[model samples]
Target: MSDERTAVRERAEAVLRRLAGDGARLRDDQWRAIEALVVDKRRVLCVQRTGWGKSAVYFVATALLRAGEPGGGTRSATEESAATGPAGAGPTVIVSPLLALMRNQVEAAARAGIRARTINSANLDEWDAITAEIHDGAVDVLLISPERLNNPEFRDTILPRLAATTGLLVVDEAHCVSDWGHDFRPDYRRLRTFLANLPAGTPVLATTATANARVTADVAEQLSTDASGRLGEDALVLRGPLDRESLRLAVLDLPNPTHRLGWLADHLDGLPGSGIIYTLTVAAAIETAEFLTARGYAVASYTGQAEDADRRAAEQDLLDNKIKALVATSALGMGFDKPDLGFVVHLGAPPSPIAYYQQVGRAGRAVEHADVLLLPGAEDEAIWRYFASLAFPPEDQVRRVLDALDPDRPMSTQALEPIVDLRRARLELMLKVLDVDGAVRRVRGGWVATGQPWVYDEARLRRVAEARTAEQRAMREYAATSTCRMRFLRECLDDPEATDCGRCDRCAGPWFEADVPAQALDAAGAFLGRPGVPVPVKKLWPTGLEAVGVPLKGRIPPAEQTLPGRAVGRLSDLGWGDRLRALLGPDAPDAEVPAELVGAVVEVLKDWAHGAEPWPRRPVGVVAVASRRRPRLVRSLAERIAAVGRLPLLGAVVPVGEEAAGGAWGNSAQRVRGLHGTLEIPSELAATVAELDGPVLLVDDLVDSGWTMAMAGRLLRQSGAPDVLPLALAVAG
Candidate 1:
């Protein structure tokens, strides 16, 4: 047995050398994890910091397991004989979280002479070939996204075979498997089903760098459970200290958004090396990237909204140090491995310290020194609340979804959106949760009711919500804490070995500049102050509108369509965002337009008049969309614009009944249904519009679904207006 163990160690060392270059040897913890997976065939959960060789452990284990080496004393004689057979062991199935991570893992696997393949959303065409490779024993490692586990075809067909034959299973970014985790993903819970179906004695590994004690234990418990709904013996958990000695952490409390932007622009060149600048919103990321580029910096904006090709190019640009920074959002948070990432600067603090740590861990992995700075914004809490609102819906909403689903017929999400009150993204997320709970099943077409009894775990969900609130509170404390920032983050992760790194701002004194150059500040202000976000016309009506008692389908008639509209700014913009949020927030009091906003509106109109896509004709009149919530604001805005433009003040379009009272919520179909036939052209307004020789300007406080504007525009065009131009104070994302 000792000789066999020695031989396994030697093979692991050789694999490490191939993966990490010559003279590379495994750390004791890395070797222990590899041994457990390759020799002992026991489950292991490794909670080590980023760049701590977590991938090395898995890749090395894959090489050994595929090579058909002898098993340890734990293996029975029959099992040992099976293990010693020719090298035809099943490939390692790694359930990774991100495409970027999978790409890195595949590259790393090749260095160890292990063939790796990926099946993700990006490569749908290649899944068949990859699966065939797995079946043919021509692949050593197969990476898949957790979301794929719930994919109907993959779940119904490929997953069962993979579970039965997988030699080893790895769950990367395993913290997402825990509801208590900062980055909880509903699809990750699907792994529980996969784990239960795995053949017994299949070694499993779950690795993450950000799991707290609660998350770590939760993941381990799930990973060790058996098929009979029974918890097995505890899995081997190896959690190392969370602290990164190479990181120097600090927080800069700038007075306002302009200053934050200015400071970044002024100091970006001084940051150690090519790195990432994180923003809370896509609008902010784009705005910052544009501002920096105008300032002569080589930077690119990266967001979930970016094209996949653009994101890939931006990532490669950063990897090759071709750009100074990639201004990004949480989309770039996990799975991006740049060993020498010099710094990570957060334009706004993430809602949890664990999430913040996970993002910052991307830096200082292979470098001697890396700077991590947090620029906490006053608007951060509002952004946090916006994201928190996306959590699992209340019990009533969940039941409404279940009630809408059919037992036999699978319904696509688009088909269900009109019947359900949730937005498409939120609705899909709820469906995933339901699918994981066995209340629904994703099939060929969409989702079908399982007819299986399921109870809403309200208490558990409430606890999770409370946990999120607590994390937000902790995040605030982290920003305000005078103690070592690194230590605070480590403690937030429940790292038992957390200590003052004696290098953070609190410990070593401030290492970053707080001053912003006046020139840079002015430039930031100018960039942000520039207004006029295009309110894209709803060219096509949402599908299945006819199912909701509406007769709409396919393309909206161009004759009845509103010309592309304009908003003074986006609600997510860094400059006007705060003021707009205050003015347009649900709880905000209805009032007349403020003078500053009036000035900005005038500027937008001026820019629109001469802009490339200028309106064909100036408005002949101004009409307001009647607002139940902000009547005063909407009426005042329309009257002011009419008075300023010297155009006739047309009366408002009035809501005929309670149907129009439906607030801006839910999917497009729901919004259009609630608005259809509910808005009436007042007799006086219709007469005025009929006499108009040019387009009528339709005014509102905000544009959310754009359905209201579309519906109102249709009404105006039918009432004899040549064209209807929609304008609003803000455009909600």
Candidate 2:
């Protein structure tokens, strides 16, 4: 190593030794990796295990790179560091996961007189100000959360300036970038975008205590590293022993929910020092906390439902040892780096091993000996199965949404919804989620489906949102298992030691496994029969499509049983003719279901038609129209029909109210056959048969309500054949 590299390395080593005590040792490989890192231009993934001094690698690298001219003499260990100047000349920006870690680092740096600042959700504006100072050469080092960095405004307005003057980018808790890691953020994918915008030759250093090969590859790809072969030596991957000898992993099988709670109470009573209890829901967290607190333990609970400040304070209280134990949902311990924790107890089983490992790993951080306890019960398993059923969306729905938009012209969400079957509100949210995952983009007002909207391919993105839901379900299964909770978790995480968590419940004690129970899989099997035939839930009971003793008579309308032709007849009888003539004017028959709704429906339909299971709970809408031929009032109505061509359906019109006078069309039923078809007419002429569109729905009240629908339908028909279904809430007498 060069003299300057050695000096930088020595300073970093001294800091580590002082912090970790004299007995701490740095691996030879770690040192060599640091040397290579100091001189490299490419980004690096320092994939080391816990207690391997991964963070030190970046600090040393940062010091060396910022030191002017590689061979410069070493300054006194206590010399005041100089402030950065201009773009491409500033201190390193370390992007981390937790605010607590940032505050701790900031405090440590302050004591040494080194300027450091932390930026997270709580202090975004302040972070912006510190970022400004970096641009102006006023700060030496800055620490921030990935969420803050992911903000586009921050990227656009603040990052470019620091990038111009920055020395290095340090990503702590880097395991989150990997699928194998316990936690993943959809926004982490943007780190690639951030790196691309930074000054060339600026080194990127990632530090995480946990990662396997796949995770390493994920990190490599995220950092935009060239993984054509394998990781570079400069990458510095220090793999420590996976075995946590001092932390005993144990599992307990509870016959029921009652036993599970009792088990938690028992464990909390005996445990000493700071501990954490992870549960599945907000209620569980609160209940468990109450139980422990009532039993005389100083306990606190946390969940997403808690206010932001409350959550932060609760976390700090845990760290400050104000509470001896914390009963919390998994939301409580992301990127928490405190090492003094004595135990981690799962009131119920964790869903996956990755999660279990992450939670259990918290206990032994500051001390050598720690313990993790798992109590699995029946309710946990039910929750898991319930959640797993939400994995995928109906295929037809996916296809419809995709087809609604032009590949060239990205339509606004509002414009697209009516054309598809999806409810206006829900489809918009899914689009937003997809946009965050990079599968789509928001341009103007609508989401433009970009790249592959891969309804089937879940592995395309590094931070796949699908896996998150899956992991969540798996967590419930893990928590509910009577088997070795650790073993089940390992299986979920795909850990090689799947059945070998030696000290777990399965390994140490008698096991009682619950047999698989019967339940209907809604998204699976052929419950709908064949296409074009609507099977209401009540009708599907004979097929054994029952869940919880009764078929859920979902939102499907009772009129769903009427044949298409009958539905059309009923609408026509309701005087929709005048309405159609008034609404369509010259083009009543052409309007298709809003273009977006068709796409949405088609997307759902295609997914269902295909094998994609577990459709997400999305809102869908269908509109039907009914009308009679009214030549006297609107002449070009025929021309409108010719322009729009055929609609999806048409049935004999039935008349109601004053429009009922026209019973003549019913006689020629053979000519047009469709049911509950939309009837277009005017409300004022309820007693008259002034005009109509054939194969109509008698929308008596709607006909009187006015010409809006009929006019729109006319315009729709005038354009071309539309899938415009019709709708009428009531048929007035």
Instruction: Evaluate all candidate structures by whole-model CA lDDT and list the values in order.
Output: 0.89, 0.51
RMSD of each: 3.0, 17.5
lDDT of 1 at 121: 96
Q: Give one digit per residue, the lDDT tens place, for model 2 in 1-733.
A: 6666666567556644544557765677567666655555556666544545665565545545554444445555443142221222458788877665676666555543346777677875576577667666566678877766545466667767766666778888787766456566545655655666677567677876555566766776667643243333344444434555456666555554444554455455556578888886565676567655765678888886788788778878988999987787777555665678888877655555665676677777667677777766544553454333333334565567676655557676545543443443445544544555566765544557676645534454324444555666666655556676555644443445445656655566643232212221121111211121111121111111121132322342333222111111111111121232233333444343233222323333344335334223211221233344443222232222322333222222332333322121111111111111233333322212223232222111133212223333332333231222333322111
Reference-based TM-score of each model = 0.97, 0.59
Which residue runs of candidate 1 sit more than 4 Å off their true CA positions? 71-85, 659-665
Query: How many pairs collide in each candidate, listed in order?
Result: 0, 129
The reply for model 2, stretches above 4 Å from the true place, is: 1-5, 18-25, 63-71, 80-89, 108-114, 178-182, 224-236, 386-439, 442-733
Global Cα lDDT for candidate 1: 0.89
Candidate 1 local lDDT, 365-437, one digit each (tens): 9899999999998889988988888888888878877888898988899988778777888889999888888
The candidate scoring highest on TM-score is 1
